[model samples]
Target: MTTLLALSDDFGSQLGKGIGAIALYAIVGLVLVLLGFYAIDWTTPGKLSDLVRTGKPNAVVVTSAGLISMAFIIVVAINNSDSDLTAGLITALVYGLVGIVVQVLAIRILEWATRIDIGTLIQSETYSPASLVVAAAHLALGLIIAVSIS
Candidate 1:
C-alpha cells in the first residue's frame, strides 16, 4: 500500500537523522576530551602522552581522571541540551568548554590550597597521595559543572 510505503520512508528518514545526531555528538565529545587532555598536558612539565606511553602510573591516573571528568560533562551537556539538533549541539559545545575551564581552575585551586605541585606529583614514577587528591578534585569539579549545566 502507498500508506505503508510512506510510513517506511518516514521511519527511514528519522532513523538516518538519529544516526547523524549520534555521530555529531560523538565527534564533539571526542574533541572535548582531547582538549581536556591537552589542557592537562599544558599545565604539566612533560608531554602527557609520552608519560603515558612510558607506563607512568601517576601520569596514567591523572590523565584517566581528566578524561573521565570531561566525559561526565559531555554526557550531562548532551542530556540537558535542547531538543532541536543545532541548538543542542551548540549547548553541548559551550557547556563542554566551560567544564574544561572550570576543571583547570579547580586544579590550580587545589595546588594552591594544598601547597602541592600537582604537575610535579603527576610526573612521579610511582603513584602519590597528591595524585589521588588531584584526581578527586578533577572528578568533583566535573560533577559540579555537569550538575550546574542541568
Candidate 2:
C-alpha cells in the first residue's frame, strides 16, 4: 500500500512538470506562429488575411500552407529539444522563426530562378496552380528544417 502511494505521488509530480513544460512550449509556439503569419503577409502583394477571408483560392492555399509549415517547425522543436524546459523553449522559438525565414527566402529564390513573381501570383483573384507549387515548397522547406532540428 505504501509503495503504491509513493508511485502515485511520483506520477502526479511528473505530470505537473510535464503540463508546465507543455504550457511554456505552447505559448512560445503561438507567438512564433503569429510572427510567421505576419512575415508571410508581408511577402505577399495584398493583405493575406483579407484575401483568405474573402475566399480567394490562391490566398487560402498559401495561407494554409504557411500555417502548416510553421506548425511543423514548432512540433519538431518541442519534440527534439533538450531536457531543460527553459532552454527547450528557447530552442523551439529559435527553430520556429528560423524555419519560417528560410521558407520565405526559398520562395524568393524560386521566384528568381523561375523569373516569376510569386507575390503577384498569390495576389491574383484567379486561382493559379502556382499556389500549389508554393505550398509544396513551404512544406518541403519545413520538413528539411525540422529534420535538422532533431
Candidate 3:
C-alpha cells in the first residue's frame, strides 16, 4: 500500500507538471498568433479585426491564413522542443518569434517582387486573386520555417 501511494503521488506530480507545460505552451502560441495578426494588419491598409468584423472576404482569407501559419510554426516548435520544460518553453518562444519575422519578411518580399499592392488587395470586399496568392505564400512560409527548424 505504501508503494502504491508513492507511485500515485509520483504520477500525480508528473501529470501536474505536464499540464503546466501545456498551459505555458498554449500561452506562447496565442501570443505568437496575435503578433502575426498585428504584423499582417500593419502591412494592410486597415485594422484586420475591423475588416473581419465587416465580413470582407479578402480580409478573412488573409487573416485566416496568417493565423494558421502561426499555428503551424507553434505546433512544429512544440513538437521539436527539448524534453525539459523550461528548455522546451524557451525553444518554442524563440522559434515562434523567428517564424513571425520570417512570415512578415515573406509578405514584404511578395509585395516587392510581384508589385502587388497587398494593402489595397486585402481591402477589397470581394475575394481577390491576390488574396489567394498571399494566403498560399503565408502557408508555404510557415511550412518552410517549420521544416527548417525540425
Candidate whose lDDT is highest: 1
Task: Please identify model 2 stretches exceeding 4 Å from their true place.
Answer: 1-6
lDDT by residue (1-150, candidate 1, tens digit) is: 355434664898899999999999999888988898898788777888998999889888888888888788889988888999999999999988888888887877776898877667767888787787778878888888889889
In the predicted model 3, the residue pairs found to clash are: none
Q: Which stretches of candidate 1 lie over 4 Å from their true place?
A: 1-9
TM-score of each: 0.89, 0.87, 0.89
Predictions ranked by TM-score, top down? 1, 3, 2
Clashing pairs in 2: none
Number of the candidate with higher TM-score, 2 or 3 = 3
**Pairs of colliding residues, candidate 1:** none
Model 2 RMSD in angstroms: 2.6
Q: Global lDDT of each model?
A: 0.84, 0.82, 0.83
When sorted by lDDT, best at the front, the candidate numbers are 1, 3, 2
Model 2: how far residue 44 lies from native, Å: 1.9
Q: What is the lDDT of candidate 1?
A: 0.84
Worst 10 residues of 3 by lDDT: 1-10
